[model samples]
Target: MSAGHTAVTTPQPRPVPVEEPVIRCETPQDECGVRDLLDRLGDKWSVYVLVELAAGVLRFKELQRRIPGPVSQRMLTLTVRRLERDGLVSRTVYPTVPPQVEYELTEMGHSMTHLVKALSDWSIAHRPAISDARRAYDEAHPA
Candidate 1:
């Protein structure tokens, strides 16, 4: 080693400790309530309807148009009714020769917009991976 040369040693990084997530235990009633809410939110049409309304108030036909894919009028009607019953949506009727009805998200429903959007974004982002997984599973199962 030359007297003028000095060896340099870099410090190693410390490992970060990850804290485990806390799992909360629910009572029977709480479980039932959660199950019921999940069932409603998990419905095929409910999330679509909520997403559509999240933009702004939309008429029945407008909502039907905004939502991607095919959705029956009857099914949309039922879905809106269920959302209304859950206090997640509000329906307003305009006074006119022919009444025009509009659907919008309530305060409670608006509160869920962030969660629904996050789920939607996640689903869209993972769609390719999910499709690949499905294809692989189907190929293996041969069904």
Candidate 2:
């Protein structure tokens, strides 16, 4: 109790609402298109390419070297071509005594890295549980 003194209340900030994403298949064409894209992005080599490109711009050989395992030149070329065709990657060619080419992610490709990283984190976190489940399933269905 003070002489003519009053307490003022502070305004509380509202929390941002989170919305669930919706993927609609209003037409057969839409479903087919989604599946086609999923197949392209979900293939064995594409994700590896994306992860490596996330580091920085790289030449074709550098990209090939960075990716682990015995990946064929043909396969890598095909993967990059597909990514570029999808507008997720850009290819630059420089002409000189010998031709030079470099590959980098487009804006769409950069945005997709977030989803890729999330998937990678999820796989790492759940690997142990997945291994346990596989082991249990194998034991139960011994043949």
Candidate 3:
């Protein structure tokens, strides 16, 4: 190359633009809504009841049977009532020789099933890792 001459190099191609997911910040109202929801559905029994009801309509006894652990009838009743109040479940009464009552998910409740199922799936998938972490923490902390 001549001392006064400079070689020209080709410019590199620009990177293709990729779309990023939109992120939303929760407002104060959103926080209140979340807190209210957590207050209503915070208990294990409520979550279990919702999960069972996600399948289909069920009678009180049937719901109890479907749940894995021991949940008292009174607790189940309360959970259902709370869910009903939250507009997450609907209760139907049929008049017969004896009155029959059934509980099923409302449209809003159905909408939440995917989220609940995803939570359950995540819990199941991470259970081993969580257990390992707990064990490690316990050992490290000696408590």
Give per-candidate clash totals: 0, 0, 0
TM-score of each: 0.70, 0.77, 0.73
RMSD of 1: 11.7
User: In model 2, what lDDT does residue 127 have?
Assistant: 100
Compared with the true structure, what per-residue lDDT tens digits does model 2 show for residues 55-134?
88999999999999988999999999999998888999999657899999999999989988888899999999999999
Better of 1 and 2 by TM-score: 2
lDDT of each: 0.88, 0.88, 0.85
lDDT of 1 by residue, 1-120 (tens): 564443334456778987864544465555635576687788889999988899899999999999888999999999999999989999999998688999999999999888787887
For model 1, the local distance difference test gives: 0.88
TM-score of 2: 0.77
In terms of TM-score, the best-performing candidate is 2
Residue-level lDDT tens digits of model 3 in 26-115 = 665556356776776678787888889988999989999999999888988888998999899999998976788999999998888887
Model 3 TM: 0.73
Off by over 4 Å in 2: 1-37
